[model samples]
Structure formats: C-alpha cells, structure tokens
Target chain A: MSTAIALHAPIEAASRAARSAPAADAARADAMEATLRALVDAVPTATLLFDADQQVRYANPAARVLARLCAPDKADRPLAVVGDWHPELLNSGALHLCSMHGSWSGEVILGVGRGQHKILLLHLSRVGADLFGMTVRDITQDSMRESELHARNAELEVAYAKLQGAQEQVMQSEKLASIGQLAAGVAHEINNPIGYVNSNLSTLQRYISQLFSAIQSYEAALAGGAGATEAESIRRKLDLDFLVGDVPQLLSESREGIDRVCKIVRDLKDFARKERSEDWIKADIHRGLDSTLNIIWNELKYKAQIVKTFGELPPVECLPSELNQVFMNVLMNAGQAIRDQGIITVTTSVAGERVRVDIGDDGEGIPPDVLPRVFDPFFTTKPVGSGTGLGLAISYGIVSKHHGTIEVSSTPGQGTLLRIELPIAQPR
Target chain B: MYRILLVDDEPNILSALRRCLASIDVGELDGEALKVEAFTSPEQALERSEEQDFDLVVSDYRMPGMDGVEFLSAMMELQPAVPRMICSGYADRDAIIAAVNEVQLARFIGKPWVDEELAAAVVALLRPGSARARAPKALRAQAASARITRVEQDDDGAIVLRSDDPA
Candidate 1:
C-alpha cells in the first residue's frame, strides 16, 4: 500500500509541472510582442506591418507620419482603402514596384496636406506566414537633380551645334576672300600684255593693207611703159622694196605674239574656273602641286627656287580644290619665310594605301613652342596685315576633312618640313 | 579717210600702233587712207573723240579710272554711229556679255592680236553695210525681258555668275 501511494504522488507532481510550464510560455510570448512594438516605434524611417489582406496591423510613430503623408484617413485601414495606393501590392503574390515613388516593392506617395509634390522611396518585405513589413523614405531632391541634369545636357547639345556652325562659316568666308584676292592680282597682270598685243595687231593689219596697195601701184607703173631707171627711181622714192620684204616678216612676228597671248589667256581661264561643291575624286598629287605652283608662281618666282622630287605615287581620293588651297598656303608660307634665294622642295611618294607629300623649305624654321600651336586659328608669326592667321588652320581642317593628317618638323636655324599623308582611297 | 582712235593705257602700245599705221602704203587704192591717232589714256582719248568725229574707236578693256565698257558707252552716247571694239587679255564670259550688252561692241580682239585678224575685224566694222543697226523698239523690249528670264534661270539653277570686273 505504501508503494502504491508513492507512485500516485509522483503522477500528481508531474501534472502540476506540466500546467506551470504552459503559463511560463504564454508570459514569454507577451514579452516578445512588447519588445517588437518598442523596436518598430523607435525606428527613424517609416515602418509598418500588414496582415495578409493588406490591412495595417501595427504602425510606429514614424510609420504613422508616413501613412498620413501617403494616405491620411487610411492610416489604420486596408491598403486598398487609399485611392492613390497601388492595388497591385495586394494582388501580386510577390512584391511589386511603385513607379510614382520609384520603389521596387511598396506603395509610397506625398502626403495630402503637403500640397507641394514630393518623391518617396518604399520597400515591402514579407515578414511571416500572413504579414508584410514596409519601409519608406523621402527622395524628392534626387529626382529633381536627375531632371536638371537632363535639361543641362540638352542645352549643351544646342550650344555645341551653334559653335560648329560658326566655325564652318568663318572657314568658308576665309576661303572666298583668299580667292578674290588672287583673282584680282591675276586679272591685273594679264590685262597689261593683252592691251599692247591688240594694238600691235591692229596697226600691223593696216600696214599690210597699205603695202599690198603700194605693190599693186608699182606693178601697174611697170606695166604702163615705165623705163627701168624710172621704175628704180620710183622704187627708191617710195621705199617699196623694204616694205615688200619687211611687211611679211612683221606679220609673222605679230602672229606669234598673238598666239603666245592667246595661250596665256586660255590657261588663266582654265585655272580660274568656278569649283563645284566639295566632292572626293581620284587625284594625282603631283599634278595638283604643279597647278598650285602655277597659280602662286608670281609670288614665289623672285624669292625662292623650287625643286621637285616626284616618285611613282598612286592616286589619292580627295577634294581637289581644298587640297589645292592647302598646297597654296604651304607654298606661299615657304616663299615668305625666305629672306632671299632660298630653296623650296616638294617630294611625293606612295606607301601601302597612303600617299605622302613632303614640302621642305631652306628658310628660317618655326620656333619650337610655336610649332605646337601652328594649326590653331588666329595664331600667326607673320605681321598682322600680312596674314589672317587662318592659313595653317584651314589647311589642317582640309586635311582632316580628307581623312588625312599633316605634321611638321622644324629646326630654328635649319628649315621646316611639312609632311602630309592622305589615303589612296576613302574609308568605307 | 576713215579716222580711227586707238586708246591704250601703255605708252609702248600707243607708239607701236602709231609706227605700224604710219608705214601703211594705200596711195593706189580707191579706199581712203586709214588715219590712226593713238592715245595712252582713255580720258585723253575721250577728249580727242569729243573734238573730232572718229569713224571707229578701239580701246583696252582695263584702264585706271573707267573700264573699257564704260568708256565705250560714253563714246557711243557722244557718237552713236562710231564702231567700237574691245581688245583685252582677260576676256571671260562675263566680260564678253557686258561688252555685247552694254556697248554693243563691234568686235572683241583677244590680246597679242594677230595682224590679219585685227585688220579684218576693223574692215568689217567700217564696211558701209556694217553700220550699227537700230533694233526695232519691240526687239529692244524683248531683249530686256530675255535678260530678266536669264537671271531668274541662273538663280533657280544656283549658278554663280563670274564677277563683271575681271580683276
């Protein structure tokens, strides 16, 4: 009997221990809930918890402020109750992005009271089996900055276009002005010779007509029973024999002079023909150099001796007139650099797909520091009136347009060398 | 005698023309002797032209004050019957057009003029049948209309006409 009572007492003790353990577990759960609530309320950013149906279950102070901003009256209501809130948050099994707030997974917006527009970033995360936690932050300044950057980029593009247009206009005007100057010089030089040649021819024609009439008179007199002595006397008086012999020679000389003048005029016409728009063509570099030399011959002939070293070069595709301008500028500069009796050498060769041209002058070379900025617009070593400072700049632009390059090497006392490399064919 | 006035800017040209004209022997021919007077300046030539009626006038295209066309036009207004010719080295299309339209030039002689060609051109101008023909009033009006159309076509075609002055 004592053994049975001992066993029953142990069973009763086990039951009481079991009942006390459940009460301890319930107290622990309550303490955990209070700690979670305190943590949520203390956070800086807006934090909220929602049930599976998207109803707001708990909101910290920060979360209450955000809720009022996003949906004032719907702070404790289901998310769907807010008119502006995205319904996709409730429908989408996974988190959905809010485009208005620029957030990957939440419904965030400016508060109704703050009538001014603002930006907000929000994130929604699943917490438990039937709960979601959302965090929100304001980001109005960031969006505004992005918009301002876009506007600045557009303005910069417009300014760049205007700068490019102005540059092109200046280049074109410089080219035209140079051509006009050349044309004036050429016309003046050509007109002087033409004036005398015309007068000489006109006078020679009259003399010829008179001589023919005189010759016919002498023949008639000889036929009309005039004696040999009388005829001889008449011939000597009229200087008929001298006229007969010299008139034909004079005519021949006049004809030769006219032919020479005609040739020069024709050459002038051909050289000064109006150029078409810039277009690439297969051009012989040597021929182009020769033409440029002819055009600028008057300027260089007295100052320099030109030497040519032409190799078997392939034709290059380029704008012929533009290339001619470059040649003229370089050649003229070379001539001007010489004090007196200097040598200008032009050499050409072909390597692979490139045609290389070298123009070297035995004149004072460019200073080392100035060489670097030679292609800069309005940079000139020459006197102000003598140069517009656009020659090298224009040449550089022309070379670049042709998909070519120009380089210079110079020693102050020795000379300067300008090297140009142009592609034999245009790149596709 | 057909009196001709030859004007040039250069003294050498005037002297050469005088020598060549003085050497002519046209005594036996029924045609009158060609009398030539040379002047070194267009201004002097114009002065001489006002003093005497010249049968024909030849002038250089380029001069100091007035161009050949302008000088010739002035001469034409003074003596409408006188034939005018332009001898020039810079005889481009624009100059030629101006010569034809402005002065009604009788002939254009390119510089370093051949002796026979010059004589022929002068003879052609002096011929009785070659007297300046007064175009009908209607034809003159048509010419004006044609010039306008020509300019319009040139503008539409985007053709850049050469400048009037060769210089």
Candidate 2:
C-alpha cells in the first residue's frame, strides 16, 4: 500500500504541474511518452498500441521486427490494421473477450510465410478509454523441446518391449540346449526297446510259419488217410509244441517293448513341452518327478539304482514343465557323479506349509573346494565337451522362480544331496 | 550238442535271442543241436561259466555290474580258448574299440540281428577246428558231466540258472 501511495504521488504531482503551464506540460508529456516508447522498444516482446478508431497508434521496435518477418509487404506501410499480422487473434474471438473483460492472454501459432510457423503468447488489454495494448512473445523453441521429450519417451517404451522378447528367447534356447545334451542317452534308451521289439517280431514270424507248416502236414495226413505216425513225426520235426508255448510269450514281450518306447516318448513330451505363458497351476509333484525320471532313466540306469521314498504331497501351485526341467538337470548330475554302480534316492515329504524334495546320490561326492561353486554356470567336474555346466545353474534359476530354495550338502568321496523346498501355495 | 551262452540285461532281449536260436535247425550246426543257456546277469553267467564250458558266448555290451568287454576279459582269463562276441543295441564307438582291443572278440553283432546273419555268424564260430571245436575233448567231456538242475525266477522276474557237478 505504501508503494501504491508513492506511485500515486508522482502521477498526481505531474498532473498538477500540467494544469499550471499548458505549454510546459505538453513538452513534458511528449518527453514522458518518448521514455515509455524507449522502454517498450527495448523489450524482447513485440508491443503495440491502438487508438479509438482501431488504427495502429504506436508500434515498438520488436513489433516492427515481427511485421518485417510476418508481413514484408506492410513492413514500411505502417501497421494500420491488427488483423493484418495476427489474423488468428481475430478468428479466436480473443479481441471480443478483451473488450468485455478488459484483458485477454493466450498462446497462438501464427503462419508467417512459405509454410513456416511460429508460436506466440499474445496478451491484450485496455490501456485507456477506447485504447488497447498488446504483447507477443515467441515460444516456438520451448514447444519443440517438449515434443522431442515425448518422442524420446516413446522410443524407450519400444526398446523395453524388445528386451522382454529377448529374455524369453534366451529361456527357450536354454531349454532346447539342455535337451540336446541329453539326446544321446534318450536315443540309447529308445533303441534298446526297439531292438528287442524288432527281433521279437522276426522270431514270431518264423515260429508262426513253422506252426502253419505243421498244420498243413496234419491236414494232408487226415485227407489222404495216412497213418497217424506221419503226423506225429511232422509235429516233432516242426517243433509245434515249442512254437505253441512260446508264441504267446513273444507277442506279450514285444507288446511290452513297444509300450516302454511309447512311455519314454510320452515322458519326454511331458518334460519338454513349452509353457508359452509360464502359467502356474496346481500340479502333483510326484508326477513331475516320475516323468522326469522316465526321460533321463537311460542316463541313470547303467550307473545307479533309483530308490524312492515318497510321502503324501498336496497339490502345489507351480509351473509343472519348468519344475520337471529342474528335476532332469539334478538327476542327470546325480547320474554323472557316479562312476560305477551307485544308488540315487529320491524322497519327498511335506513339513508344515513347505514341500521338500531330496535327491541324494551315493556316488563320488564333490570336494570342499568345489562344493560352493556347483551352482555357478559353466562349472563342471567332467571333462570338457561332455558337460554343458548349465544343469545345476539352470536348476537353481528354475527353483528360485518357483519361490523355492535349493540347498546342497556333500561329503568328499561319500555323496551329494540336493534338497529343494517349496511353498504349497504361491503367494498372491 | 553245442552249448551257447547268451547274456543281456533285458529279459525280453534274452527271450528274443532264445526264440531266434531255436529256429536254427540242427543241420545248420553240422548235425549238432544247440542248447542255449541265457542269463540276465553277467556275474551269474560268469559263475556258471566256471562249472561248464560253452561253445560260444554272446553278451550285450552294457549291463549293471559289468559290461560285455569286462565280462569277456574275465572270461578270457578262465577259458582262453572260448570264442566271445558282443551283441548290443547301442554300438558305442569306445566300447567297440575296447571289445576289439581288450577282449579279442570273435564278432560284434548288433542287436535286432537278422536271423540268417546271426545264425550264419554262430555257425562260422562253431565250425570244425574253430575255437570251440579246437578245445580238448577232455574239457568237453567234463562240461557234459555238469548237469543243469532247474531254472529259478528271481524277485525281479529274471531267470536264475542252477547247475550241479557230481564230485
């Protein structure tokens, strides 16, 4: 309020002095107007004033510069009309708003020439009775910076999506590489059943032909009224009794062989099926273990005997296929740990709300120095080119993803025990 | 009579071998009949080998306690003159090299052996002046004295061969 009173005292004094000497007052008024024009002209904002007839009364230096760029034809002709340079102001009705409210301010994008454009902040106000003043501030550079920021943000979103796709691809390739490592063992397992089954079929065919020859001989003996002695000789020579007794056994054994091959294939499919969405469902842990064992049985059969001590288990919420992969990796390691015959004991039990699976091998155990690094990727005790070294590491990752913990305990030259603990239900 | 020893871990394979050998006529073996003594375990087969002599021995390459090469190597120690062969479903290169170098294998017949080829291979092994035929007559007589008592089935449904030798 004191500053307002100080400003009012100057104006009141000037007016009082003007009333005393009209000629001197006119000279002073002209000097004051010149000072105001110099101040407005120095500002970066383009300033303009209009008279009651809506004609340009004053144009500051900035305003004149704008006129030169925007309307070169009217550059020296004087800004006779406000609409000539700022047509948007008339179209936006901001001038009508200013007449009613005494002031208006907004941002406007104005086309200059040759399809070029500039952003301007326009402020219009009534300076005196029937007189108006306006200011325009160029703000095109500020808007350009904001749009560049938005474009950069969109690029970042695309990059993030690509990274997610790459991560999933890595997971898939790792699974396939693990299978390729086990392909030899699986092939051997299937070959065994197929070999016997194929042999069995050939033997069956020979035996059937022999039986058929015996039947033909008997028919001839009966039709020609030959003595029964000839028929007995034919039976003994053809070994009909042996064929009758062994045919059923051969068929059953061949069927069993085919069934085993089918089971191995089914188990492999169960273990290797891709979970595209990584969907979690309530699944039986025993089934996963059993199927995994079936798939890797060839790797273990020659080296170790598997012993199972399964306890009652509730349906645990988990990814069945990924968990099976973990089982296969651990079991394969257990098999490789044994140089000769040994025992691989698999035990599962529930303690409180956690389900525990323990896979123990009575094989050449890990030494103290190598025990801690077992879960590290590319760590292998086997000779190079025989092991991928990712078995245990991948298992660790899978178990951790299930919100579980895998712990290993070992004694040098005794054995290694891998124990996994998982919650019965996943936390929401 | 020609005594042939067949060993494999899978009982189905043993049965298939037996059936296949049964189809070979006595005429195919120089008028001599074949008596196959098949075992699922190499250790038991080795124990049986100690009591009696076999004309020819065919064993699967992979087994639980002992592989074919190891069993044949041990067999060579007991009976140096007996002819040994390996019949395996998986022909592992290392095992084949070991069989050739260590056991002096008579033949390496793959599993799912063609009836004619396997029979022909066996006939060639048991021909006159072959390893089995070149054995001393006294050893053959001694093998004839040991009698097979009875076939027993174990808990796992494997056939167990029992033999008795008169003192």
- Predicted structure with the largest TM-score when compared to the true one: 2
Residue pairs with colliding backbones in model 1 are: A69-A111, A258-B112
Per-residue CA lDDT of model 2 for B24-127, tens digit only, reads: 66765667889999999999999999999998899988787788889998888888888887788664555565566677666667665665556655665777
State the lDDT of candidate 1 residue by residue for A208-242, as single tens digits.
67667667777888789777887687677666776
TM-score of chain B of 1: 0.70
Q: For candidate 1, report its TM-score.
A: 0.50
Reference-based lDDT, residue A276, model 1: 56
Candidate 2 residue lDDT tens string, A74-149: 6665456677665564343777788889999998887776788887788989876666788877778888887888
- Interface RMSD over true interface Cα atoms for each candidate: 6.6, 1.7
Model 1, residue A111: what's the lDDT? 38
- How close to the true structure is residue B27 of candidate 2, measured as C-alpha lDDT? 66
Report the poorest 10 consecutive residues by lDDT, candidate 1 chain A.
A1-10
Q: Which stretches of candidate 1 lie over 4 Å from their true place?
A: A1-80, A84-115, A119-143, A180-184, A197-278, A367-373, A401-403, A411-414, A426-428, B1-167
